[model samples]
Target: MSTITYYLDMQRPEQIIGKPLPADLSVVECQHKQYQLNRFLYQLVGEPWQWTDKLSWSDAQWRALIEQPGHRTWVAYYQGAVAGYYELLRDAEGVVEILYFGLAEAFFGQGFGGPLLTQALQSAWAWPGTTRVWVHTCSLDHPSALANYQARGLRIYREEVEAEAP
Candidate 1:
């Protein structure tokens, strides 16, 4: 199988500003919980990336990744259950990357994605000296992924097609 991936970027501070969080939604910073992080990723990304192979990372690797400096993960709660989450990484050069962002399959289309993304962008922009914020999405991602980014003012800067092993 093959997929087309779009690389989107936002360099100006204006682009990173996002709407306020909805009344019932709240975001909590996840801390030192590799198992919970991995489980959340699997639940949110497993369906969209089904054509690709499953993720296989040891617990230690997961811990290392999550514990790295400048790496931040936020989980969204809707009246108490896990609804969605996003991870942000800020490099020394002041570039903030939205490494992963998604709503759980069960929470899709219930007005969660936008607010989640808004909070993610807001968090990214809050970092001192942050000059760029970016993320990548593929054809294999949710159908609304591309549109949502565009709607939030991220511009498509590059795109490419690649084959995926079955």
Candidate 2:
């Protein structure tokens, strides 16, 4: 599995990147100049649930995301192994929202994504002066990710089509 390092991007919606993890699950911050393509992978990979960057990513794309603001990324380490990753961003009102997220494909369904998400959400929500959070996934009747959010206490306030891409 690939391990991603995080660095802060200060362009638009500022964020903390990398936020690395150590062998025993300790967290550290990472700073690098390459672009990370996890978001692009989520946007262009296989089906929604099975979607990911299942290809060898190039250096240029990864570096661009590193330089983009309002984006954050992090990798989880379990027993010295790179286990998964996720990112968050804040809205204009200072509420943290999930921007991109995924676990190592091999770690799927082994009970990792949920806890990792739980931990990340807590960290985001705990940020001072933060308020409600909202994340939108497919609203075309696919329910797994939505269900997970509801189970976690995120009320589905409204249902709508995918937000137009920029």
lDDT of each: 0.81, 0.51
Model 2 Cα lDDT, one tens digit per residue, 25-136: 5332234422444544344323445544434555666555556654566666667665666666665677667665555555556555556656566666665656655565
| Residue pairs with backbone overlap in model 2 | 6-17, 6-18, 7-17, 13-70, 34-62, 34-63, 35-62, 35-63, 36-62
**What stretches of model 1 exceed 4 Å from their correct place?**
31-36, 51-54, 163-166
**Model 1 CA RMSD to the hidden true structure, in angstroms:** 2.4
Top candidate by lDDT: 1
Q: In candidate 1, where is summed lDDT lowest over 10 consecutive residues?
A: 45-54
TM-score of each: 0.87, 0.57
Q: How much does each candidate deviate from the true structure in C-alpha RMSD?
A: 2.4, 9.9
The per-residue C-alpha lDDT of model 2 at residue 63 equals 55
RMSD of 2: 9.9
